[model samples]
Target: MISELVMVPTDEAVLTGDLVVPGHVPAVVLFAHGSGSSRLSVRNRAAAAELHKAGLGTLLLDLLSEREEREDAATARHRFDIPLLSRRLVAALEWLAQEPNTRDLPAGLFGASTGAAAALMAAAERPERVYAVVSRGGRPDLAGDAIERVAAPVLLIVGGSDEAVLGLNREAAERLSAPHEIHVVPGATHLFPEPGALEEVAEVAGRWFLAHLKERRGPGGRRA
Candidate 1:
């Protein structure tokens, strides 16, 4: 596997990220970390490792800059700004499309918490670019009408013990227009901190992305 530190330009800021690509990768998964998290998130990194082992490329991006994150940490202002976050995610996707290494690969998204809303919104906006989406303990209901516009297949994975979020995922699933499913991880909480719970999340997510991303690929292994 090859790992590179990349700076992705957006309208307002140049976000930093780690792009990891394994040999013979067919697809790339962009991770949208939840509120109060960055590319250094342990869970997201763990999941990315699993995806890499599955022969997929991964981008773990810090959606917010250091200054912006500090500001949000102080005021909690930008964390829930779905439109802003979506724009940044879309910018990253555009950048990826232009990069030689990942330009031809189908793209998928892995979102957690509020980042799921941004991921969904980005998917809705770029239906031709994104092929699949997986949300781990996500708040998809926060996506509102944008959820209905997403064409890519979505898999919402929530912890069974996290009743409130599970309910939210169920409600969002009802509003989805594309193929979608809600998978509840038993004995796990909002963070899936229980032993083996996070592994389950990673396994399910890897399978979902591998299947859907490959299915969405165009001729000669390019993104359709």
Candidate 2:
């Protein structure tokens, strides 16, 4: 696997990112990090590293501006700014779609917290481009009415100890029309705080991406 720190040239300054290209490149994962966290989030970076080893590429980008992060941290709305963050995720997706390394390849999303909502919103906005989504202890309710508009499969991974959040993910899962599943990590906290729990997340995520990110033709798995 080859990893590099890069930038996605966008209208809103340059979106900083980490690119990890695996040997086979079965799919590309666009990550949306949780609140107050940057692309350097250790948990997400760990998952991305495993995905890379499993022949999957990943682009982890900052979902908020430095100024926005500071303000949002002060008000705690930066992580909850569903609309603004979702739009940014969509822009990053479109930008990735135009990149030579990821263009024409199946794409997946790995989102945590409100970032999950942003990922879901982007999937709804660009159904044809996103093949799958994986949410880790995310607040999918922030996606609002976009849930039904999403055409790809979604996997919601919640921590068992995070009972309240798990319930929310269950409700969100019910509203998703596409193929979906909810997996609970027993004894883990909201952030999968338990030891070795994040490793489980990485394995589950690898399987999901491998299963769905393959060449899906159409409704009947036909090549359009």
Candidate 3:
């Protein structure tokens, strides 16, 4: 396994992340954290651990620089800047392609909250590289027109009780032309704090990645 702290250089700033890839894993899932969250998010860490059990790699990144995070915390700025976030994510994906350990493996994305929208945008921008996408309590509606361009299969995981976001997810699902599904965690809230709720999210997400990431795309951008 390769586990380390890495720096991803973007046009504007350098982002820090924790990368862990087990030996012989099929794919690496890059995590896009929600507003105000970081690479150290407990929920995301738990989910990454679960993915590891499925022989998948994971990279948990802070989409913001330290200065930007502090500023966002105080003024609530930068977190909702979907374009900036998506650009940073796209940069990370490019960096991963150049990284020695992950260069040959297919990649997937796991986004949470607003980060989901950014992930979708990045996927739209780099369709040939991203094999699949998974969103956890995500705001895919925020992706706007980019949702229609994503070529990879997608999985939307929402808490059953997060009604407003669930409705938004349903609307976004309708806009997506790519293969997709929505999995609702019964009685769980937006953060899935309920007992066993997050575990369920991790399990289902792991399974989805296992199924989709292993398949190669054939002609006309369809899964083979």
TM-score of each model, in listed order: 0.97, 0.92, 0.96
RMSD of each: 1.1, 2.3, 2.5
Residue pairs in clash, model 3? none
Q: What local lDDT does model 3 show for residue 147?
A: 99
Candidate 1: TM-score?
0.97
Which sequence of candidate numbers ranks them by lDDT, best first? 3, 1, 2
lDDT of 2 by residue, 1-224 (tens): 65778777656656778887776575799999988898999999899888887888999998777777788779987688788788888888888788777776778999999899999999999898898999999999889999989988999999999999999999998899999999899899998868989999999999998888654655664434
Instruction: Show where candidate 3 strays beyond 4 Å.
Output: 217-224
* Least well predicted 10-residue stretch by lDDT in candidate 3: 214-223
Using lDDT as the yardstick, the better of models 1 and 3 is: 3
Candidate 1 residue lDDT tens string, 80-152: 9999989999999999999999998778999999999999999999998999999999999888799999999
Worst 10 residues of 2 by lDDT: 215-224
Clashing pairs in 2: 217-222
Worst 10-residue lDDT window, candidate 1: 215-224
- Candidate 3 lDDT, tens digit per residue, 48-120? 9999999999999999999999999999889999999999999999999899999877789999999999999
Predictions in order: lDDT:
0.94, 0.86, 0.94
Better of 1 and 3 by TM-score: 1
Distance from true location, Cα of 218 in model 3, Å = 7.6
Runs of candidate 1 with Cα error greater than 4 angstroms are 218-224
